[model samples]
Target: MNGGNFMSYVIGIDGGGTKTEAVLSDETGQVYARVLAGPSNLNSGSRESIEGTFLKIFSEIKNQQPELFQHIDYCFAGLSGTENHVNKEFIEALFKRLVGGQFPYLIEHDAVNALYSGTFGEPGIVQIAGTGSIGFGIDQHLNKKRVGGWGYLIGDEGSGYAIGRDALQVIFQHYDRNQKETILANLIGKYFEISGDLKDIVPTIYQAESPRNHISALSKVVFEAFDMGDTDAKSILQRAAKDLSKSIEMILEHFPLSNKQVVLVGGLFNRNDVILPMLEHFLNEECELILPKVEPVIGSVIAALQQINQKYIPLQK
Candidate 1:
């Protein structure tokens, strides 16, 4: 789809704390290629790591079809650091340099891509619960509001990190009150590789560079405990669901997405059945409609295409 005059390609990328994915498509919405790589989250990885990952991905794509570079019409990078102005500019500049300023760019928070994914490029709310948690959306009038996602330390209440941390707390409470006879206690000990007294757990988690991983490691515990019919675990999950729903409520009240469709993304949302039911209960009570599923990468692609439209790039080939 190229000539000496140069056919253009549009690219969409979702860069997260654990992985990054890129989709390349031509006009008329024909997908050309898709690529995946290590974490591009600037907060999680150093500048060198982010650049190295991008360079590696670009090199791999170039090896396949070097001409694709010149054809890049526009690129949308929905990366983890998009919320921060400095990080956003840094990534945008880095990309411009890497592509030799050939393509225009739209860099945004990964949440926007998630929200875009849910609404299929329309307007809606998206609740994400990965290593961290955040809820974000834009209304029809272009008004945007977000809840939680204040990083692992302060917020991220319903996130994997939060779930895991709470599970640990549950275990500690059991120890503190001398309660016994539970699988969770044994599981926690094994997961953290703690054999002796559990008092050391707090210090171990605090010392890690990314404490999210510590809490993230216990998300499975939430699921397992629930499966085992542990009332305490069920309570924890219920609380998480409530917290997530509360975020939505906050967004709806403050930003007024009263009648918009709501979509759920992220691994935890997909995997945990408990959350959906709880979330559905709350949303229904509030008169909200829920979509079945939304592949967020598709939203990323749509966002990239919008950028292409902004450049007044004619669709005619």
Candidate 2:
């Protein structure tokens, strides 16, 4: 695809803490190419690292189809950790410098993209429980509210990291008390290949480059143990569900909407059997639950379209 004068194209980027996704599309909303790169979250890495991530993605596209790069009309980026106004402005400036300001662009929080993707640009609430947890919503008046998403240190309750952290605490408590072996303890140890003295787990976590991602990975182990009917793992999930539900409730309270559709995103919600039912139980039918039908990257594209007063039907892929 060469840059033809008549050809109109756009790009949407979903930048996360772990990785970044870019989707190239056209005026009709048909996706042409997709690419992935390292984390672009401003808070997760240095400015140089974040800039390199975007450059890498754009360079790959330029190299593959120079015409598409040249003809791009708009670019929308929903980047995690860009919630801070200073960070957002810095990223916008960096992107303009990197891309030569050839196309119109907008930068927003990743949760905004997720909310748009969940509701197809309609007003609704979206709760994310991936490596981190956050709740975002848009009301009928177009008023937007954000709840939670305070990062892993003080907040992000009910996130994968939270669940895994709770599981780890359970194992350590058992070890500290010299209690009998528990399924959670064994599963965690086996998953990490740690044996004998459990005290070594401390350094293993503290010394990791991305401790949050490492801990979030353990959420899978929690689910696996839960599958085996482990009571401790189930309890951890129950707590996570309750925490996530509270976030949802907080967003709803801040933005009152009757029968609002609630969209669930992130890996934690992948196991509907365990988390979804509990989330619903807490919601008590206050809102309708919706599993994401499209990726957040596409939501970025929709946001870009909305900027130009255009609309497109989201095709589930």
Candidate 3:
């Protein structure tokens, strides 16, 4: 590649379980174009399906702006479920083949991109609480640590699934006690639009195709109930915050940087009104919370730029 072309552009991709997002940017970190594709997580979909998604997104970009696509000099991808070395290798090889191995690239787990996005590729801790929960950190020495990314079956203590599962348990307990209908119960019923006894909710959830996602969606109802002054709902969120805080604590135990900046990401953190204050209460005095200035996809771009020794100020909207 010529020096001018090499210095012109880069690509950053954030591959999630549900969808994939890509950003095309100039050397100065100015975004040129953004594209969306289907899920590319190897654990969630087949190799062919993931490849197809990437091809489709890339084709769109090429067709829309051929010059920009041609100038893309570096690619950095953060993919969910690529934590295993073999899986990561497969993805890297696949992209290399798809892109003709022309541009240099790096593939890493999605959490790494989130961490980079939160900390701008610097040393800091990041806690993600979306459909799943995990705490990741990097120290000034470049040491990395992870806490509680075991998925829904084992861990994900402070995730949306956890909060929804706890809310379901509370609703069932109310049903078993034959007590007056609580706000949580009513909210659950309305959210699910169930017409019969609440016990039917058990089969509705248990028999769902994607039980994790189904349960995670119910977290919105829990939040609504909390806003309506439901004590049980408040307790559930509080416990979730405490659990997430514990994950942060665990990561801190490994890094332990004074006045460490911590970044919170994912859908659960969207309810900052409920979770942020609780998280602040639980975090150590030396830990400070910082909001993400850009989305994780842009963070991937930042990481890609770092690979080439390029620096760009992130968007701070």
**What's the number of clashes in each of the models?**
0, 1, 0
Which stretches of model 3 miss by more than 4 angstroms? 1-8, 62-71, 314-317
184-237: candidate 2 lDDT, tens digit per residue: 778887887887766677888989998999999999999999998899899999
Model 1 vs truth, CA RMSD = 4.7
Candidate 2 lDDT score at position 286: 74
Runs in model 2 lying further than 4 Å from the true structure: 1-8, 56-73, 98-101, 197-200, 314-317
In terms of lDDT, which candidate is stronger, 1 or 3?
Answer: 3
lDDT of 1 at 73: 70
Model 1, backbone clash pairs (residues 3+ apart or across chains), number: 0
Give a tens-digit lDDT track for model 3, residues 41-105: 87878888898888987787777778878777788888888877777887877887788655788
* Superposed model 1: Cα runs more than 4 Å off: 1-8, 27-29, 58-63, 66-68, 190-211, 284-295, 309-317
Q: What are the models' TM-scores?
A: 0.82, 0.86, 0.90
How does candidate 2 fare on TM-score? Answer: 0.86
lDDT of 2 at 6: 47
lDDT of 1 by residue, 1-317 (tens): 23345545777788887789887765445566778888887777888888987887677666666777667777777888678877777787788888856667777888777877656567778788777889887887767787888988798988888888888888888988898446777777777787887776778788988777867878887788788888878888888888888887787787665566677776676565677787766553453445423355656777776654432132452
- Compared with the true structure, all predictions reach lDDT values of 0.73, 0.83, 0.83
